[model samples]
Target: MDAEIEVRDVARRYQKGGVQALEGVSLRLAPGTFTAVIGPSGCGKSTLLKLIAGLEAPDAGEVRLAGQPPEAFRAGGGLGIAFQDAALLPWRSVEANVAFPLQVLGRSRRAHAARIRELIALVGLEGREGALPGQLSGGMRQRVAIARALVSDPQVLLLDEPFAALDQILRRTMTIELQRIWAERRITTLLVTHGIEEAVFLADQVVIMQGGPGRIAAIVPVPFARPRGPELFADPAFHALCESLMAQLAPIADSR
Candidate 1:
């Protein structure tokens, strides 16, 4: 099967060789799959995501979305991103904030208005449509960010710690909600996160990264079925994947 997302032998350097953010890194995501990338900070997790998003140019190697350049794919409105920061415009109401992407893309506001409403409802923020970003809690803002990302129905979704601002309990709740939302769309997704359980629970494949000038240390396919729920936590394989991922990240903590 052809990969929906591919990163081949990618190397990126910053500050004229001050730091080799990534070197010889490779990755692939099958069409309609969810993949999570985890590693110590500065391991180039975000860099790789940026390269795939066409936000940065790799010093070497290439990133392809469906065998075409990221820019070309994105030009067709095939790319979407939700960052850890909600990055909502404080003055805009939730509805307008969710509709911001459409406005930026010069899409017809009337044509996509129903989709904007559907996304707002999809993210469970229907009643808060008129609320301002400052009026909502951190999690709600992230929800708005998510709705903004998906309102355009991009074929590939890129997420970077979209739930990082929430507390543990809320983060878990949002994680489950995100899974349900993702199930509805089934877009190819790559998420960069620090939460092992989050990564294991949400990913079709959990990629563990280690070493400087980051490279894929291991990739473990999730063993559970889709539309996963809390019952999945009871599965032995779920706990095992969590434990295994923690083990891989353990060394990074110890060496620090």
Candidate 2:
């Protein structure tokens, strides 16, 4: 079952001298849709993702997954998250790392063996399952992380800068690969990214944020058809939209 995410008038503040991170930030992601949040540093992008992931509580307002609170839905194994760092255990093989979520939930590994294998192949790490994280390259390690995240068959997937560390070429490749993987199973996905082009490419809607107590600036719907190919990157309309989004961000940049 796919899940929807809702953030309603959310606010957060750090206790150390009341550093406000987010204020009146709200977003709703319909079931099986992809939404990407983009903004400058200190814009509370990761803070919002963490809130949806149940890692922190808002000082005010609420976040819900499938109409239930984040913690309640997460307890049922409905959420999956991947971060910028692959964060794989150096000692664990690709296959073992991908299976780690099941281990954490106390599910029998044998019962999920086929699911593990499918996710490995899905992420294009098929024959390298036995390879340890130390043996894989940066992109490959991130692939392992992605496979691990999806192994739980989550209804909602959250990603924070999942491809930010790669070189330009590798990052583009991984972005395309991510789109392909996402097409296969349209989980409700929320990605927080700094790359404007990346946000425009992978998201159904591109959400722009402003800092100094972060809040939504705009939500631009992506009109391109999918499976979005490499050629879309070259399309004039694509560049036009990118330029328009850049224009919106310019003032925000100037204000910072």
Candidate 3:
């Protein structure tokens, strides 16, 4: 199968200088795979997402989507992104927010209404379609944002700490919801987050990054079976994986 996304020795630096956000990073994501990137703050996790989304170009190396340049894929709606914040329009009702992307793509209302309804239901916000972003809780808003991201039917989904703002209970709930959605949609997903457990819970593979000119330190495959539940968190195997990832992150933590 073709790689859904590929990064080859990618590197990036800001205009201010002396700060290399990423250095010689590379990865290949198989089609329909789910991967998570976890690292310390400022470790270029978000930068990687932006490069893949074509929101930022790398100073060196290449980012490709299905053998095409990042630019082409981005312009063709091959990628979808969700940020730390929901970034929803407060004025738009839930259904309108989910329909925003379809409208941008010039899909007729009649053509996309059914899709919009399906997405809202997929995100578990079926009856709340008429409400505004401000009327929903943080978790609900993030769900709306997720629905909008999927409305375009993207080949790849890029998420940057999307569940960071939710409280513990809600965050866990969102993780399970995300897993269910991914299983239903089968889209390749790349998530950048600082949470170890979140990474382990949602990813088929976890890529750990080292701080200060970020680079991949380790690639850990999640050995657990799918359909994971809260009970998995209590398993010794789960804690062991967390400990191993924590060990890799320790140096970055100490340097800060």
Candidate 4:
């Protein structure tokens, strides 16, 4: 089967030869798959996401999405991205914020109005559409950010530690919420996060990266059946998976 997204021998260096952000990394994301990348603070997880999103270029090797280059795919409305911060315009109302991408692509308001409403409901923010970003809670703002990401009907969603700012309970809630959204949309997704348990819970595959000149250290398949809920956290299988990931990441921490 063809991968929805493929990274072949990718490398990225930053600071004009000061630091290596990523070195010799490669991975493939299956269609409709949810993959999470986890590593230490400077492990290039976010850099990888930027490469796939075409926000940054690889210093070497290639990143392809459904057989096209990242820039081409991104320009063709094939990619969506949500960052750690909601990054919403404080001045824009919820509906307007969600509609921002569509407008940028020259889509008429009438053309995408129904789709915007559907996305609003998808993220469970129906009546909040008229509110400004500052009026919403952190989780709600992130939900709006998610709605905006999907507004363009992207084939793949790239997330960079999207729920990391929330309180633990809210973070867990958003995790389940994100899974539900992914299942409903069936969009291939790659998430960059530092939380090991979060990676195991949300990913079909968990990729652990080594620190500094970051590189893939391990790729572990998460065999847990989904639509995973809080109960999955209590399962022995889940804990075992977390333990295994922790073991792989331990060496990276020790080396620093």
Which has the greatest lDDT?
Answer: 2
Tens-digit lDDT track of model 2 for 202-230? 99999999989899999999999999998
Error of 2 at 201 (Å): 1.0
Best by TM-score: 2
Residue 62 displacement in candidate 4 (angstroms): 0.8
Error of 3 at 9 (Å): 0.9
Question: Residue 232 in candidate 3 has what lDDT?
Answer: 86
- Model 4 lDDT tens row, 161-196: 999999999999999899889888888999999888
Native-to-model Cα distance after best TM-score fit, residue 169 in candidate 2, in Å = 0.1
Return the clash pairs for model 4, or none.
Answer: none
Report residue 160 deviation for candidate 4 (angstroms): 0.2
lDDT of each: 0.88, 0.93, 0.89, 0.90
Candidate 1 yields a Cα-based lDDT of 0.88
For model 4, how many clashes? Answer: 0
TM-scores of the models, in the given order? 0.95, 0.98, 0.96, 0.97
> Which residue ranges in model 2 land beyond 4 Å of their true spot?
none
The Cα error of candidate 2 at residue 244, in Å, is: 0.9
Count of backbone collisions in candidate 1: 0
Report model 4's TM-score to 2 decimal places: 0.97
